[model samples]
Target: MTDTRTDTRASAREILRTLVGRDDADFHEGQFEAISTLVDDRRRALVVQRTGWGKSAVYFVATLLLRRQGAGPTILVSPLLALMRDQVAAAARAGVRAVSINSSNAHEWAGVLEQLRRDEVDVLLVSPERLNNPSFRDEQLPALISRVGLLVVDEAHCISDWGHDFRPDYRRLRDLIATMPAGVPVLATTATANSRVVTDVAEQLAPAAAASASASAAGQPAGPGVVTIRGPLARASLRLGVLRLPDSRARLAWLLSHIDELPGSGIIYTLTVSAAEDTARLLREAGHAVRAYTGQTDTAEREESEGMLKRNEVKALVATSALGMGFDKPDLGFVLHLGAPSSPVAYYQQVGRAGRATENADVLLLPGIEDEAIWQYFATSSMPSEHKAEAVLGALGDAGGRPLSTPALEARVDLKRSPLELLLKVLDVDGAVRRVTGGWVSTGQPWVYDQVRYERIAAARLAEQQSMIDYERTTGCRMEFLQRALDDDTAVPCGRCDNCTAAWYPSDVAVAAASAAAASLDRVGVELEPRAQWPTGVASLGVDVRGNIPVGERLAAGRALARLTDLGWGGPLRDLFAVQAADAAASAAMTSACVRVLADWNWEERPAAVISMPSRRHPLLVASVARALSEAGRLPWLGSLDLVGGGPDGSSGGNSAYRLAAVWNRFEVGAELAAALAPFAGKPVLLVDDLADSRWTLTVAGRLLRRAGTSAVLPFTLALRS
Candidate 1:
């Protein structure tokens, strides 16, 4: 056994040398241990180390050694597309032939499967969602599971509900590990798991221990045990600090004034897509070469931006968390956050992108007052509610084995598109439903909603948010505080952070630059792209809508003064729209801003009249904006569209089809309004509203006016709900 371990270590060193292109390259302290356990002992192992610690090296080296012994290809389940791309490139440098099967390269899957069949690929990297895909799960996964020599779970923390970014799809990995042949080694790795998450993941990695006490009850035999290896969670090259600015303008001013002084090219992180886009625009106007990256960005453009940042062609990428995890740049010099994340684990994961290969890197956080609200939004969205789950099950059961598409399911449920999809994924994992070629069908299996478990998870998330709040206000060492939060035993004062030493970042902002930033943010006008296709399954609700909306019935692409989540006016808008706040007319500043927006709008034919959508909650606000626009634009004040009945109340929140059904035919053109609109028969009319959320109300109302003899309708709102 000793000789075998020694041989494994020697081969690992050779592979490491090839991987880094240097003869003297060696393994980190815990890398060899993990490799030896997997290659020689053929045992399961969990490795929890810091970001830059060589976790990939362990898997690649183990794959090379195991393949030399005539084992089948190693199957690696990765979490992110960027991570898979980087790993494929890293494997090539080590002389290992690797291929990836993910959503981006569906066209290449046939060739990849052929390579796998021929044993031409050494490593096969795939996303976690692919495991549940109907064709792959039924036709390919079983054979691959039997033939795979080793299994690797990267970013394994996501498997645990205790993790900050827990993913339901990753929980499917537990079953996959259980079915592997005995003695086929398994390895799980992550950099951000706390003690609870680490324990949870380790149990999942070794199913035998999890089943040992309940084997008889479960009617299955125990499998194998696991070994855990954890390392210190400190990044020696990072210099951490926090800059608490009073508002968005100050934060933007600080970036404009100090971006050049930062060490090298890095990322500027934002909490929302609008913030990223707005910040990137303002920075470019101030003469910085930067780009915005978010989930909304095209895949090709995202890849190009990643390459530009890697090559140091751009100073920074104003990005959301979309750029986190698996992006590699050895010389990245700085990372700045425009707002704090909800948990230290997530924050550490983002900041870890910098200073991986450099001697020093700057890490700074600019906490926002609205951070908690953002956190609450995400937290509530992520948790699956019992009511939604029950609604989905009922819908599936009613289908009677007929597969139902997501849109069809959305029409039947009260949840929105995204939350419904997430709940469906969770149900798929729990075996209550199945995804077939057409869509999803009920399994007719009895499943219980674990209310106790879900409540516990919600409580844990709230605790983490409080911990994050404490992290920002802590006067102690910041790095040490983060390390302790992750339950790292070796955490200590780094003597490098701002708290440990003196202030390392500039706090003063240039007055002129700040004024410019304020001006840019204050300038509000966002284009609202019109919905071209009517939602599917609307006919099921007795509505005649189906397929593409007729061009004559559609509203023109419209405009909003700002998004309710915008960095500039979002705070005031949120306050004004709060449930507890009293309904009032629009403020003078808001009215002025709306008038300026109208003044700058370049219409093909100027609007001949202005009309308001009748509102129940904010009637004064909507009426005030409509009157102001009518006065400023010198257009006729067409009376507001009259509500037919009670109209849908504030409780209406659901998918597109349902939302449309709620408001369809709910408004009728009164005699006075019809007469007022007749004069504008051959010209455009500006339709004003207090807010635009699903846009279903606007679409239905716009169709009514267009049919009532208006030539065109242009929708405008005080704010948009993204």
Candidate 2:
């Protein structure tokens, strides 16, 4: 008995109401407003969004909106070839005619180009390298762009040197974009761009338009059009650790153990091809299904390796920084820095590779004493400041001011080896040069995003570098320093780190001083809490089944240590420190105790001293106690920075268990902690921390005491309270 017309009208109104009520399910009002302005103006715009912001979604929506309005074919310039493939795939999934043209294409590209010319495609993806191609510019681009209504530049930061993966060709994109149809809107997007890059992008793409706009405009050419979509780095779910290692062997061991123990897919990033291969080999030898990828690897190898990891055929991967530039796998669980990268931007990019699928991810940095020297090798060797400008100019001459191969330019320039590359990179940042094929070439003109302003914006970046140096030398409140640096005024000491938990807590003697009238408890207040219970005022949680001694046999050290950590002891004692008794004639009591009692003690240091303690409970106790010590902030000098374990000499060896005490008391270590950790620091001293179960966590704590001029190794006993 209801009217059909009225019922239909009511249903339509209800659908409209549902959309309005679910506005929160979409973006905030402000985001929609900003997007609407960009789409409506039909003018090219730059969108500065932080990582995890729905940057791609914004553009996707914009693309669809523009298409609906009868805009021409949308051209998307992606920095990475892989990213182009990913986008095209996504477009295809969305039922759009999307095709990519890159170096990989031989026959398919011709068809794609034909489709573009015929206006049969809705989107065409190209790499920046292809945009610089003469044939592309002379024959393909003009025709292709003529049909383009919207031009999109993804990861826009690649155009600036301040960006981690700065590409010389990106600077030239502005010039080529200029040749496109007038009034064709260009939308540039990136996850990370400082103020300088923002200004540079504005001037380069929309120069005249930005120039005419009001100077007081927010995120404008006079300023930066950045929409602060988010505020502050999130640290709640993030547990940061730093470990110092002594040698590469220990580092490898540390990596083996940590990678074995870490759950989910992980990436171990190295600086060079050789290191990547070596790391993968070591891990594989340890029975881990690990794959290696680097710039030298053929594209097929890279793809296969990536596929294996994605499909869970391999548990871990060792790769150079270039391995996953455009990769979109979302299930990444952990990121390990086999070596420190050249810049903070590099650090963010590599680490950002993790936790992409709304999953938890952890990052580990393992540095060694030689780390600085290696980085100095990376920074100062061939690219010394004095020779940079000359080499760049020479390369320009070699190219006859035309694009040329990198090898050819190196032959033409007569300077140090690396400075030429650095200079080229620098010029590329300045928009004075572009990298094409094997050579350097002029883009025919300068762009608005100049290097000078970029350098200025990159100033804060040095503070992070300085923090690394300070970590090498500092001895106090390493956790406090790290928290302050990463979170600024809101930083608080993270109890998870060695320095905050172990070094800062008061000694037993100090507590007596504070409570002079109280009688000393006979039990020493040691209470045994099950790992599941997580006792208050105790940072370590380990279960001692069978009373810390299984059948009174000394051989059960490794199993006992694992049990302790599983119970929540949370440290590196699954092996290194354990139960064994030393011979009295061969070693001093402490040394002998470490040998006979411990599982792996070498006696090269003792001068006629002997006697060893039985180690049935030593290793597990040491690890458990160390965990407790670190969490209580009694040994604040150790475990501050985010790193792997330190070696015997207190350098990070790339292993997790090897990260001993974080550098706490000193201002700088005189040498690099590892081949990589040193280069980031301008000086030697810095504060640091450790990741859980990393070798450096155990060794550095002991080693740093020596560095601070203390000769004795501090020991902790774990006897349950009566």
Candidate 3:
């Protein structure tokens, strides 16, 4: 018989060599075994290997081998559009035809659909989000599902709620796997999962494992189940280190002072979009070739930025997590985090981007005190609220089969856009709703709250955060610390880590660099544009307001001293607003910054008086700014807005519809304020507040001021929350 297994092995070797374009290319320890598991045994498997271990190579080779046997196209579900693009390009190198359908290429979806119909695509790459998309789900997915040769889930850790980055969309994969055709080999791969995450992913890969396969007395499975192949996760090329800089300025100064000494073009990760943009701008201003790649970057700009970095045209790409996951540049030099990620697993995954194909790569962390607060802001809202979930389901039920779009649902629900979308995904996965062609409709399926699971996930996250803090302070081998965090059994002290070796980096920041960085931080003031139109469906919230604001009811363009997320003044402002920080008079620096912002203001008409907004959290802070500005300009202090019906008690983070509803009719023309504004009837006035977020507060308060007889209300704030 000529040993069919040997012939198949030879064929797989050739495919791998062709895919990488090197005759010398070969599989790592478990790559070929995984391919054979899929190709020969036709069994499901999870590959928990580290980055650069050729996880993608196994799937591409298997897809080609199956195609040679007349199997239908493989379906590869990736989490990011960028990752999909990279995979499609990678597939091309293997001479395998691949097509993708995502938000970025809606115009080409029809062609892709046609290609799929013609059976021209060897692999179809789609985002996990696309699986729940109405058109894809209703019109295209069924046909594709019936014919899919193999199913591949990339970044599989996301399917586990215990993972650091648990996404609701990835939960849909379990349902997909459950309904897959019999005998189809499935593969799930990730590098960041710990023990819990791996176990969770394995269960999802075989959702009915307990019932479908029962071990006999011989300790063998009654049927085939998912097998996990894990390897040691130590990265030999990464020289891991941590620098405990005193403050944000010192970190930036160190970066400016020593960036040239780093090997090649690399990435500097930030915790926020604003931080990325600020860092990139500051670096570029200092004559460094860099670009900001954030979620806010448009598709074309993102492509250009990635290309610039890949071509080594830029020294770095200051980025948030948006640039992460499968962005391959083999010899990329360094990975530096401006602030630590909350989880060590997330940190490991991020730093894994570097030194993949190089002899040495640098990985460093600069921890910040503010990182915890940022982490809280994101983690607090990650799990869906039961109250909000009920509201969404009730709204959908009220529609009675009419597909309600996301915007319409937003109007009917109190949650914000991002959280609303997340809730919807969760509901869809829970069988409470179905995404149809138009939008979402109630499925009339009862959904449990899963309180226990949510609580456990939250607790796990806190522990992960504490582990990251320990990571920054650990004296043990840095690489070994990460390996143990991931539950690797083979962890040992890497000879190259900072703890294992000496401090191989410069620690002292130059005086000139520090001064320049401080000056850059001193740059302040952000222009605030007034909200022009009322939120759609506000009338449903019991407010009759609609359409664009009439000229008379609108506030003029305003200015803030800085954004709350700014690098320069943000720290002081954040401290001022901290929960435990007592309210006090404005600091001299703040008063001076306020005066400078006013000096830079080029409004068509200067304010003749000052009025403060009603403040529950920062009364003294707001009052001090108003009083200082009033004294500076020698203008009348018209007093603050009166609190009506206990004031707007809605929380700080609610969506626009509810925010407006909460404040509507809550403020009235206080007899004293109305009387004081009589003289400045048509003159502009500075309306001071502590912060500008959502802008709904400013809009509602400004409308009241305008209706109560005031000229252009120049809304000024100490910080603009972006």
Candidate 4:
């Protein structure tokens, strides 16, 4: 009664404390005090929080504090649809009313506006791309300005070119924020952002700091200073290994063998969607649970696969670079690359999906010599041509504001065949034409993806690739280089990569380097995982073994091995020995162990299984062995094993042809095809001249061999070299 105002304030504080206590809210000392200061000062704040940091709490607390002071609902803009959904769910759990406004609900504009006007929604999330919508200003925005007390942008770095995945609309968000009611607060957050981006965002949101109370006096610095966090990048528990391959088939086989180690949680990234689908099909045929994700997959399928991945139903996912944005899964143990990614930014984001919970994880990149060519393709191919652009604009035929299909326009245009697609793509960007169905429609204005700007973007990428190549081949601290590039001052040497591992302890590196060099004489050099039919009574021998008994022993191991060696591997057998035995009884109980040792020893993949029979004149022994080898038709090229008995009549009694199953193994195809395939190790070598005019044939064969395991990949040629 003596002080009614003071009593009311005290009662409100008690109610707030009790509500927070219901959720077991532990007061974070100084956390809210700083936020309260930011609110009181009415300043715009951009916070950079590392992964696992409670960044949401910062904005969350700010929202609650400001709303308590009679400010309006908070407007949060986020780029990801999934993250938005999760936030909505979390809001319900926290007893806060939230509304999401996105393209999906464009028809419900009126109802959403009504809710915003009534102050029924405490938080509203929107996509940046929606700003261009006609209704943003006409019907919905008035309520937004009147009710939006706090403005929050999640993943705010998307506004900068340096961001991992840039979305053009993010840049427009800054201007949109500036249009907010005067004195309304703004807050932004990102898991990663460099200093330049931070400064740029600050300028965008509060350009007129002096007019607002949040601004520091004249030349004074702002309060609640930016805090930079530090942490180690290496997870010591993970064992890292790097393996280089000659082509995709060997890579495929290696992945197939180790797939048991990967589960529904692992990811396999390819350079393109076609490759992803091919790899997925191959894995599926081998009876593994797998799926593929690409930019082109229908939205429904993409969502289903994503749900399956989250539920741990799909064992493996093959995808292009588009699948990795903000995808958080702590159990992801492995991130395997079927090939090198298009860029280091793509590479980093894909690999970062693993080891979220600090559990042991692996990131594997199967680099090949041809990788640079693919990188060059993406770097060079996207450029647009002025000629093409002209053709496109000409196609519009005075219809400036009309929408058209890009494909249809391309068909009508007469530009250089190669650059036409890029030109139309550019026009879509320049806003001259918006993408519609398979074509483009005129937008009455210029856009970025148009022909004129295509070259500029392409040239920039080429330069970036050049820089990446230099960094990739450099002999320096990788983390340091990355840190320097990202403009972070605290990047220390991450002693886990090839270069850092070598630099951290030069003595050990030097010793290992020398040992490797010395051991190279005996080592096979070409590293490959053990083939499926490993250690199975097969001796892959070289034809140079002209000695009768040794040759006989090699021959007896399996005709497949003998044939492979005779094919040309025999030419290099002195330097490289190839043998495989998948039969446990034929070798030992430790087939997997032997394969691991061989992998370390640089042994490559070869068909290594064969049926064996002891030397015996007995008909049953000969007949039984012949039947078994004949039935084991899977190792077709790997000749059958027939241990010759001591008698002169052994050859006559044993039926060598049937026993070896040369007919089944195709040994009977004469030494020519066997000889040709022998060098390939079952892989199809691209016959250039053979497919000079019939490249389609070679392409088909390549697809078939890819489905089969570990086939030799041949180079595209003008004519057959063989």
Candidate 5:
């Protein structure tokens, strides 16, 4: 008789070859072992291999093997839409039927569910976020749990809050594992986990088996333990290097000068959306083909761009972290960063995109001086606040069991959108709340704020930030530094890296390149679209507003000299808003830019008057800019709007409801400004402010002015705060 091992190995190799569409395709070194543990031993396994490693192949091959032996279909919990799409295509090549139920394909969810019920699907993919979805959690998930042959969690490092990109949604997997049937093999795979994350995930993976082991004395069946297969994290094909520039300008120049010299079509990563869009535009203007990918990009647009990069149709994709993990492009030529990522682990994960299936790929970092400030700004919103948590809980409890939408809850809390969304996820995972069809409802479960855990995670993040700085400045082996950061003990100098050899990349920024880059960044003015619809739950906050504001009462589409995050005039604009800096008049250059904006505004009619908002933080700056624009356009200067009880703080950057509440009826259309505007009663008047955030301040002010008989309110600002 042919041995089972021989049969299994042969079957797996055949599937691998077919899946890759290569006659000689075979499993990587640890791939077969992971497959065997799953198929032969029926054991739980955690594979923490590097990016290009064949972790997906192991589970796919095993899934087929388990089905042949009469085991039920595999349930795969994936994290991204792109990943699910890729996995389904890969599974089909191996003759494994895969179906997914996610937000994008909601129209086809019924068919997919039907496929699952009929056992037509060999593998079912669902996002971790969907695991707690009320309908799925209440019905489909429980049925799937009873008969699932194998459970797989991709990008499993997210299961640990200690991981670099800890997602609270992934935490729901612990409860998932606990309720899983005994002896049902489980697989969790990731390319980015450090030792700490590995331990936490391993413990989480075996909770069911642990419980079964403890009950063995009472005749309950025992279960096997979790097995981990981790390998070296080094990429021999990657030549890593960091070139520090004096500022943003130099970095853009460096990218412009050397982009063509890079090996092949790849990625250009930026920290912010504006940077991605701006960089992509500059590259295109310089006669290179590129596209920008950010969290803000429409879903269909992102897919189209990803396909372009994969097919080598575009020279590069200027992107943010949205394109990070589970994106597979085996021969991706390079990964160039416009700014250093905040964490070393995240940096490694991004750069791992290159050299996966090639002999070599270039990886370069252009570290900017503004990188740290950007890092701090992004980090501030992630940590949950106890006070905010209590406020949200209190608001939910007072609802008397009715669900309150996120917008409605925002009216009752001081937290901003980003932080409030994060808090809701944390609460949902901790059993403190549940998300029903309408919105969120309290679970009435006891919740303890884990201050120490959050503190520890915060400390780890700081250490990682310092590590990223050290990585940038390190003269030692670059590959070794990254491997060590991921807690791989086998790390050693990769002779291919720049630090090991000489600098393989260009050192000097050509004068022409610098000049071109500067001219490219010399852009000014962005159209700021006016808010047409009022935020919901406004009346609850005593704002006396709901639904769409009448077009006659709305502020005309406005303009800003520049965005605070712009590559051109952003530096000067940022300096003006420094927290501790004394209020000062607008600088000459900024004043000139504002004049240029007015000259090019393309407004249908010139303003008959100028009005400034009451500024609590920068009265002089607002007054100066208003005065400058009025003098430049030769329009009447209608003194600042009056604040009744204490003008809207202008300092609070909360949600729309709160901002509107603070600004509503607070700006009085006093006689002084009204009298100045009376002469221009039938014409447009320019309303100026130092900054525009939430846009409600401008919205409320314009509504009042329109009601007081101004024909049109032309809103303008020094900068748009995104």
Candidate 6:
């Protein structure tokens, strides 16, 4: 046994040298132990260690050792494309031939499959979402599972519903684990799992016997047991701080004044896409090299941005949480947040991106007053209501094996596209629905909507939010507060935070810089890209629309004074449209801003007339803006379009098809408006509204005006909903 242990150590050392290209390198604390549990004992294990703790090294080393012993290849379930790319490269360095199957590389799947069949691949990296692919799940996955030597679930915290970044697709791993052959070791690893998430994940990774018993009760197969090894969550290299700014302008001023003082290329995280883009624009205009990274960034652009940041070509990537998790940069020098995240676990995870291999890194949070509102939006968006889930299941059941595309399903249900997609994923995980080649179909299985479970999750989320608020207010060690929120029992004052020591950062913003930032943020006009295609299956709703909308009927690219998510005007606009806020005329400041936006708008042709969308709630506000614009621009004020049938009580807010259907025939050009528009034939007309949410109202109203002899319709609104 001694000889065998010595030999194992030697082999691990060799693998480690190959992995890092350094002959003197060795495994970090607990890494070899985790490897031994997988390789020698053939037992499942969970490693909850800080970032850069050699978690990937453990799995790669184990894969190499197991392969040498003639075990089959390791299958790694990764969460992000960026992560998969990095893992593949890292595996290659260790002489482990790795191949990935993800959305971005569909064309290479054939070659990857060929390599897998030939046993030339040592490891295969795939996204958790790939587990639900019909063809792969039914055909490839079973064979791979039968022959696989080990399974690695990277970012394992995502498997838990209690995790900050819970994904329904990750839960589907239970089915795969339950069906795996006994004695095959499985490794689950993450850097961000707190005690609760760890416990939840461990329960899911319970021994095959327990899993079998539970599966038997649930009428499924058993899974494997897991041994968890958790390490200290504290990062000694991070110097944490939180600066409370007066408002968005101050936040921008602080960044502009101090971003260059940051150590190296880092990330500036924002809460919304608009904020990310706006911040990036501001930084760039101020002569800082930055780019926006958000969900809206295309795949190629995202890869380019990642590469630039890695090469230190850009100062920062102003981004949303889209840049979070599995983005590997060993020497990332700093992480600054424009606003606080909703949970401390999440905040810790994001800040963990910094100081991985550095002596010291700065982690700062410029907390904003608007953060809670943004948090509330995301929090509610993620949790599906029972009624919505029931509606989805009912729609699928009524389809009776006929695949229903998401748009078709959207028409049948009241949920919007994003929430509907999330609900479908949850249902798919529960085995009540299946995604096939065309779309989604019912599996004809009875599934319970676990209201109690959902409620518990929601309550936990609220607690996390409260904890984040406390973290901002704490006068003690900020890092300790974060660690404690993660249930880290060893959490203590690090004496490296602003509260523990003195403020290491400059707190004052120069007057000129503050004014410039304020002006940049306050100057709002986001181009509203017109919808070119009508939503599919709207014909089924008796709307008689399909395919691309007629070119002439579509409004040209339009403009809005601001996005409801923008940093500057967003706050006041949100209040203006608040549910309890009493309706009133547009404020003088808002009207003047709208006029300035109109004057600055470089439309192809200046508007010869103006028209308003009849508003039931904000009629006075909408009318005042139109009248203001008409007078300032010296354009004729065509009357507001008459509501033919009550206008569906003002856009209950669902999918595009439903939103369009709600206002399909709800408006008409009255005799006076039609006559007014006829005189402006072949001339541009400004279509004004209080707000633009779905843009369906704009689309329908624009079509009506264009058909009434206007040359083109230019849409302008007080705000655009993000």
Best by TM-score: 1
Task: Give each prediction's root-mean-square deviation over alpha carbons.
Answer: 3.2, 20.0, 2.5, 18.0, 3.4, 3.5
In terms of lDDT, model 2 sits at: 0.49
Candidates 1 and 3, the one with greater TM-score: 1
Candidate 1 structure quality by residue, lDDT tens digits, 1-722: 89988888888899999999998999898889889888888988888888889899999999999999999999999988878888999999999999999999999999999999999999999988899898998998898988898999999988998642356889889989989998899999999888777767867877556434232111122345667778899999999999899988899999888999999999999999989999999999988999999989998899999999999999999999989887888789999999999989899999999999998999999999999999898887788888889999999999989999898898888788888888998898889999999999999999899888888888888888899888898999999999999988799999999999988999999998889888987987888877789888888887897999899999988899989889987778888888898889899999999988887888777888999998999998898999999998888888788887887784546888888888888898889998877777878899999888999899999999889888889999998887
Q: List TM-score per model, in order.
A: 0.97, 0.56, 0.96, 0.55, 0.96, 0.96
Error of 4 at 508 (Å): 23
Decide which is better by TM-score, 1 or 2: 1
Q: Give the per-residue lDDT of model 2 (tens digit) for 483-593.
A: 343333444555544454442211122332223212111101111221111112111112122122212111101111121221112112222232243211211222222
In order, the Cα lDDT scores of the candidates are 0.88, 0.49, 0.88, 0.49, 0.87, 0.88
RMSD of candidate 2 to the truth, in angstroms, is 20.0
Candidate 4 global lDDT: 0.49
Prediction 3 global C-alpha lDDT: 0.88
RMSD (CA, angstroms), candidate 5? 3.4
Clash count per candidate: 0, 145, 0, 41, 0, 5
Tell me how far candidate 1 lies from the true structure as C-alpha RMSD in angstroms: 3.2
- Per-residue CA lDDT of model 6 for 1-722, tens digit only, reads 66776788889989999999998998787888788878887987878888888889999999999999999999999988888888998999999999999999999999999999999999999999898898998889988998999999999988888652357899988878888898999889998877667767767676334333322221122344566777788999999998998999999998999999999999999999989999999999989999999989999999999999999999999999989888999999999999999889899999999999998999999999988888888877788778888888898889888999887898888778878888899988888899998899999889888888888888988899999999999998998898888777789999999999988999989887898898998796888889999987777777988899899999998999999999889989999999998889989999999998987899988989899999999988899999999999999898899998677578556888878888899999999898878878899899999889889999999999888888899999999988
Candidate scoring better on TM-score of 2 and 5: 5
